[model samples]
Target: MIGTALRGIFTLPDLRKRVLITFALLAVSRIGFWITVPGVNYDVIEEIAGRQAGTWIDFIGIVTGGRLTNASIFSLGVMPYISASIIFTMLVKLVPSLERLQKEGPQGYRKIQQYERYATVLICIIQSSFIVAWMTSVTAGNERLVPNATFSFRLMAIVSMTAGTVFLMWLGEQITEFGIGNGISLLIMNGIVARMPGKFSMFISNIARAVRQGVNPAKEVTELAIFVLLFVGIVAFVVLITQGQRRIPVQQQKQTRGRRVYGGMRYYLPLRVNQGGVMPIIFAQAILMLPIAIISSIPGLQSIRFWFNYGTFWYIFAYVLLILFFEYFWTALVFNPIEMANQLQEHGNFIPGIRPGRRTAEMLEYILNRVALAGGTFVAFIAIVPQIVSSLMGYDIFLATILGGTGILIVVGVALEFVQRVEAQLLAREYEGFMRKPMRGR
Candidate 1:
């Protein structure tokens, strides 16, 4: 099936073009990941990163694909843009004016996008400033990451990082316009996947070291096998949840027009179980990082740090609560039961055993809440898998992240999205799709 899909993809001129464009743009972005901001020493930053494993520094590296580790021009990556989008998305719901603007159709959407761009720039400036100051302050045995931290250097870093992010934003937009899959997501997934080879190598090297020391490498090897099995199970579980949906049967009223039946059909409205996707996890992680960072930075607050530490009981509890909260929060923001009900009513469609107005809306909200709770619980569980693996398996947090958890979830989600996109292109052109039998129609 994969081989057939590969052939089918390149067989079409337009699909081939989109595929090539996506790869080309992704290659350019990958190159930018290595281009450091001027005057920052990559070697020193890497050294500091090594010593600071399991901190927010490592988290940033994992998310941005090593760009932050080098203080690269693209260090900010697409996160600032993502952050801007998330902020504006919430605003559009909470702010009446923004909500009105959102209802104005494509023109309003474009305006909101413009505002998000402006916000992205402002966020980049604020974030980059802190990053610059932090990097210059980081010292390794009398050697600073930024040797000469001058105003000029700060200015250059700020401009360089912001420009890099803006360019990446533009590149992602282009990919959305002309390429296959979501550009920004593809970029992020690529970043995560790019680091995998090195991590797997490190895991392998650790096993070899254990064998040499006669530390009973058998246990570690057993762990590796278990890891693979767990990974496959988790992936399958993710795909199932990601694609899971509740199909609400809707009936259209039969209509008579000049002795001809104009309507009367039954179809299902598929409401996804995990409509919020990875947003909940992303939001929870961002919010969780703050308290730990703030508390750890304060003098004499070291005793309280463990309370907010990643794997601690209180920390995990709060993290799970946040995930559940944000799952409903984001779902409420994006999905409107009222709107769905209105559309169904206007079209003379009604859910079986439910009225076409407020009742339908109420039912939808009820079902959505239940579905979202399940999804939220699943995501919260996945989020803590890394912590569990790190503690129980005795693997480095970085290594554990790749083996299972948010990293694998994002990788799987994005990969599935990408393949589905390519498959869609193939199906549109009457070609067989990846991991699917040939359809009867184009």
Candidate 2:
């Protein structure tokens, strides 16, 4: 199946070109990850990162595929840009003036994008402060990571990292223009996947060692087989949740022109079951980290950090609540039932039995609530279940997430989206898509 898909992709010239461009851009970004920030001792940076293992720094590195510990040029990754975009996206939806601008189509979108870029630079500088403080901090024995407390060193670190992030932003835009799937998402997935191979290799070696140590090899093999199957099942479940949607049927009223009849038509407005995508989990995790980071930093509050440990009851419970809250919060911002109803009414469309105005808005909002509940619940489950299992297995939370939890979920979602896009391009050209079976009969 995989080989056939490759063949299908290579069979088309345009798609092959896009795929190559995407890979090239992704490679360029990865290369930047190794370019250490100027005037910082890479070894000392590593030492500091080592001391802070299992903290937010490590988590960010895993999520973004950036070498923060190395004080690399791309240490900030695309996160600053992503943060800026999310801020601007929510503002665009919430602020009436921005909303009006957004409704103006392509030109408006371009204008908004320019605003996001400006915001990205601001966010990059703001975020770089924390990283710089961490990088320049003097350790217990007088060891210094930056060694230079001078203003030039600090200034360069900030400028270099900010530029790296902006370059990534531009690279992502280029990929989107001349490549497949979404450029930013593809970059995130690339980062996540880049960190996976080493982890997976380690996992396999551990499994093999355990099998060798076992008195019953066959039994161990069976258990490993079951674990593999369960992993596949979970991935499939995520795919279903990612792609699931609640489609509302709409009917358009018939209209007649002077010499022609037009209008009466039926279609469905599809709302994704998981409308929030990874944002809720991302937000919940990030928000929870703040208090944990602060408490851990305090001299006598280290004990309190234990409660916030991954897979603990309070942590999981709070995590679930945050995920649910952010999902609804995001849904409310993105799904405006009143606006939807107005659009439908303008187009002479109605949701069948539902009236065209306030009633339709009411119906849509009600349905959206139900959909969000189902989606949020599923998303929380998908997120928490892996952490619970990883904790039970006594694995490091950092390694576990990179191996399975939110990390794998993001990879699966992005891969599925990318495949769908490629398939769309293929089908549009009267060619077999990725899933199209090869003919075997003579």
Residue 154 in model 1: shift from native, Å?
Answer: 0.6
What is candidate 1's lDDT per residue for 1-442, written digit by digit as tens?
A: 8898899878888989999999999999999888888898766876876777667766765665545776889988888888899899889988999999999999999999999999999999998998898888888887889989999999999999999999999998999899988888888888888877876687577689998887978876777787778778888988888888899899999999888997789999998887777788777878888776787789998767778777889988988999999989988989999999999999899998998899999999999999899989888888888889888878677777775556677788888899899988888777788877888574
Candidate 2 positional error at 239, Å = 0.5
Best by TM-score: 1
Q: How well does candidate 2 score on lDDT at residue 373?
A: 94
Candidate with maximal lDDT: 1
- Per-model TM-score versus the true fold: 0.94, 0.89
lDDT of each: 0.85, 0.81
> Model 1 clash pairs?
none
For candidate 1, the per-residue lDDT at 431 reads: 79
Q: What's the true lDDT of residue 290 in model 2? A: 89
